[model samples]
Structures are given as C-alpha cells and as structure tokens.
Target: MKPPFPTLIATAAVLTVAVTVAALAQAPDPPQRSAGSPPPAHAFPAPTNLKVLPKNLTGEQVHEIMEKWKIALGTHCNTCHAEDKKNPAPDGRPQLNYADDTKAEKSTARLMYKMVEDINGNYVSMVENSGVPVTCGTCHRGHITPEPFVAPAGNYQNNGPPPAKDGEAPKLPR
Candidate 1:
C-alpha cells in the first residue's frame, strides 16, 4: 500500500528544505579587494584650541614637520586622488584640471590649504640663523591622531563583473 498522504507530504517538504540549505552552503565566497586599491583618506580629529608650529623657526625645522605628517598621519601625497609625478599634495586632495568643465562646488581645496598651513605652525621651532625641520616622530611619536586606521567594511571595489566580451552582458542568479 501507499504511504500515508500526510507522511509523504511532510517528507517531501523536509527534503526540499535540506537540499536548499545544502546548496546555499556550497555557494562561493564573496570577492576580495584587488591587488592595488589605495588606502583610505587621511583625516585628523578636530583639535579643540589647537596650537601651531613654534614661531620664528628655521627652514629645516619647518620642512621636517611637513614630511613627518605624511607617514605618521597615514597619508601619502596621493591621499585624495591622482598625484603629479613631481609635486604632491600632502593632504591627498587632487588638483582640479583647469580644462575640465566640472569643478568642485565646495571649497575643499581652500580648506585643505588652510589645514596644511595650520598644522605646519603647531610644533615648529626656530633655529639660530638657520632653517627648521620636523621629524616623523614629531606628531606620530607613534600614534596617528584624527587619521586613525579603520578596517574596511566590505568588498565593494573588487565585486564588479569581469570585462564584457563581444558586447554581451552577464546574467545574475534567479
């Protein structure tokens, strides 16, 4: 005789669920970051009543701090976007292409310039009849402030589809 109707229906339902879960478990892992993604931007915590570099410093001391900001602050010249081969902006903001029709409506460029100037004055000291310089340890001393490192949240950058061939589009799962 045939199995009871209720028993057969329950078995089929259970099997279906088990198969679906198993299939899902076997799915591929998500993509990871590509080889050469740039690091996040450099930023500082807004210091309350912050001071500037020491006044009347020599050229060397003045320059030393600027260089230190790069490594200690977790920013390279290309922090914002593409960098020029020779000159690079310490803060990472890209320079606007004069020929381009589009320009950033906001005055971020001015803000960054002011920020760089303000930072330069903070701990700078003057030397006797000479220039001033800053060391990497000047601000970093080991810790990165305002520009602390935060781990990436997800793999957004590397998840795009492979290059299209013969103008055909890729299909997604149903």
Candidate 2:
C-alpha cells in the first residue's frame, strides 16, 4: 500500500537530512591558521651539549643524526629531550633543551650509542668483510628496548652445561 503524500514527504525529508549529516560528518576539516601566527618553518636549532657525538658536527648534521635516532628508536623528539624551562618558546609549546642530559633515558641512550660505535669499530671490522657497519637498528629494530632472550622451557638441572660427550673424561677444567 502507498503512504499518503504528506507521510511520503516527511520520510523523504528525514532520509535526505540523514544523508547530508553523514556526508558532513565524514568531510575533512579545512586547514586552520591564526591571522597573526605563521607556520613553523624555521630550521632546527644547533645542538649544545653534544657529549657523545662529535663536537665539530654542524648543527644541520646533528639535527639529521637526531632524526635518524628518532626513527631507529621509534620515539618522538620529547622522548629524550626535556622542556626548555630557561628559554621557553614564544608559542607556548615546550621548547626542548637538546643538550640537557638530566633525563636518565638520555644518558642510557648515550651509553648505548657508544657501545654501538665500539662494536662497529672494534668487533664488526674484525669479523665481517662486508664493510657494512653495525648500527642502532642492528639490535633496537625500531624499538626503544630490544626484546630479551629467554631459554625455552626445559627440565635441565642447575642450568649447567650439557653433559660431556661419551669417553671425553667429562672435560674437567684444571
């Protein structure tokens, strides 16, 4: 049976409103900017307290290296950087003190960087002829902390070395 004309019009109006509302909801918002505010296009500031990295590195080079560390550790700028309480930015966003080593994580990262450098220089050079050096990604794998190794479940006693081979005199150390 067909509904009355008024009823059909009301149903159509409701459907139209629903469709319009849905479309508006899904539409992307227009870019917003303040009349007096400019976009952040300034170059990154030069590094200050470069304890682990070379002191002679250019500010731009330091910035690029930091960017790589950010990617390798799957972290943001604030992960190791503390807010610049002394020289805050005008925009009210936390300005970072890139040189600050107060944060424990930052210190730990410094140690890790040194360890990686030593491994690549001293160890990898000795063992591998590939010429490709080890990097933070060798172990971190885009994680802040590499996964720990754990032995599989077993009934071995004392966690001692495996039994000596037969007739090997138990391989006792003098």
Candidate 3:
C-alpha cells in the first residue's frame, strides 16, 4: 500500500523534524560525578604542622616515633637503614665517605633522614645523646608528604532560609 507522493514526502519531513527535536531535547550532558565515588571535601591548604616530641621519654616511646617516621618516609628507608654487608653502597643516596658532616645538605636524600647527634664518643647509641636531630616530621608536617584526601566534615548551610539572588521574582509559594 504505497502512499501518494506528496503524502509520503510530508510524512518523511515530519519524521525528520521529530528526530531532530528529540535529539536536541535528549542531548547528552557532561558528567557530574562518577559511580561509586565519595563526595568532595575541603583539604588542608598548607603542609602539615610538625611537632617535636619531648626527648625525655622512655626508650620504647622514642623508638616508636622513630619507627613511625621510618614508615612515613615510605620507600627511602632501604637506602639508609639497609644492612651493609660490605661497602655501604658508596655511590648511593648518601655517599658513605663524604667527610661525615655533609649528610644533610649534600644529597637529595634529606627527606628520608633524621638529624641525630652521636650519643657517645665511643659508640652510636640513641638515648645517650645530649641533643637529637630532626626526625621525619621535622620537614613533613604529619609524616606523610602531600597528605591524604580529607573529606569535608559537615554541611554548613541548614534549612533556615532560601538563597537570595539579584534580579529575581518572589514566588507566593514560599
């Protein structure tokens, strides 16, 4: 059953117009958020605030913070604390033979080291020192650099009043 030529042309025009209108009405929009994603939060704008733990403490507590600092430094511990069966990786992070006093400023490895004064003239022990050096937090505020994402805690605006905008109409439904 073929329609007349004029009728068929009219139907095709209507169909094309309908398709165009539908496409415009249902046009895709940019993404607002991803699936399985958490809401955004405000982060600390600055680096962490470093706190120096008091030196007068039990050996266990001091060692605990030191261990924490070690973990905070992440993967760099091996370059310093690794067991040296032979030469101390001479050309590695901190040069093993660089006249002893140049440990901090010479290499790109200060992020992984704590400034510790020698405890004894005879031996290198921790607790006997007159003054201790800076730990990892001495540079990094909390131990972790570029701190983790912190979610904003609460919604500041409550259901008190409607938001006001300039040049707007007032609705009686309020």
Candidate 4:
C-alpha cells in the first residue's frame, strides 16, 4: 500500500531538516580569541610613543587606560587624539594619530595625569590607613570639565567646640 500524501510530505520535511542540521554540525566553528588576546575590533598594534605614561606598558595596557580616562571624562579618543587625515581607516574614516601631540588637549591630559600621580603618590599616600586613590572620575565625574562645587547655604551655629582628640575632653563654646 502507498503511503498517504501527508506522510510523504512529512518525511520529506524531516529529511530536509535532518540534512540541514547535519550540514550545520559539520561546519567549522567561528574563530575564538585566546585568553590573552584582545578582541579583533580593539586589536591595537604595539605602541611606539611613550611619554607621560609608563614606557614599558603594552599597547593593550595603554588602550585600557585610555578607555578608562575616556569614560571618566565623558569624552572620546578624538578629544585627545588628533585625526590622521593622511591615512584613512578601511571604512574611510580618518584614523586617529595617537602619538601626535599637536592637540592641546593631549598635552593637558598628560599634565593632568602627572598631577594625579603626584597627588596619589605624594599626598594621599602620606596619610596612614588611606586606601582611596584619586582617579580622573574623582573630580571629572563624567564631565569633560568638572562643574564647580557650590556649598550649601546655611548659617553656622556654635553648637559647641570641636570634638576632642584621642585623649582630650570636648570643649564647650566660649
């Protein structure tokens, strides 16, 4: 006896799906990044210019640091890195000339980096048990230029003398 038309159609559909699944299973896997490898989109060549940052740092390390600073300052690479009009990227966008110091913002960034390093190493470290290190976000807080701090309006009341040190008793207001 011949199989019903619906049975034939079902068999054909099942065969088609099975063949497709087998073909997909035989296909090679997509390329994977090694543990130490950076993503293909962010693959940076070895850095040539070393100035304010540590000379020993790798391109990836520099990229990571710059990424942090970019986020902290609510800016982009173009803010500090000049565009290389001479060389365009594969997509025809102007490539960033990271080593170029022509931009004033780049110089200012270097100066700011040095200042932060000094603050962290010289000032913050001086206080015993001080664990917090100042970073770009400490002041910038996601702004390119930090907004000026405004003190809350209030009348100072002489509640009492300042709290005493370790051994001294609190003094009353005169």
Give the winner by lDDT: 4
Write the residue-wise lDDT of candidate 2 on 50-143 in tens digits.
8889988767678778888889888888898888898878887678888777788899889989998898888888875658787877778789
In model 1, how large is the Cα lDDT of residue 107?
Answer: 36
Query: Which model, 3 or 4, shows the larger lDDT?
Result: 4
Cα RMSD for predicted model 1: 30.2
Report model 3's TM-score to 2 decimal places. 0.21
lDDT of 3 at 78: 39
Model 3 weakest 10-residue run by lDDT: 42-51
Local error of candidate 1 at residue 58 (angstroms):
1.5
Q: Sort every candidate by TM-score, greatest first.
A: 4, 2, 3, 1
Q: Say what the RMSD of model 2 is.
A: 14.6
* Candidates 1 and 2, the one with greater lDDT: 2
Computed on alpha carbons, the lDDT of every model, listed in order, comes to 0.46, 0.75, 0.44, 0.83
Comparing 1 with 2 on TM-score, the higher-scoring candidate is 2
What is the Å distance of residue 34 in model 2 from its true position? 32
Better of 2 and 4 by TM-score: 4
- Candidates in order, TM-scores: namely 0.20, 0.59, 0.21, 0.66
Off by over 4 Å in 4: 1-39, 154-174
Query: Mind giving the per-residue lDDT tens digits that candidate 4 earns over 20-40?
Result: 676556643223233333346
Model 4 scores worst on lDDT over the 10 consecutive residues at 28-37
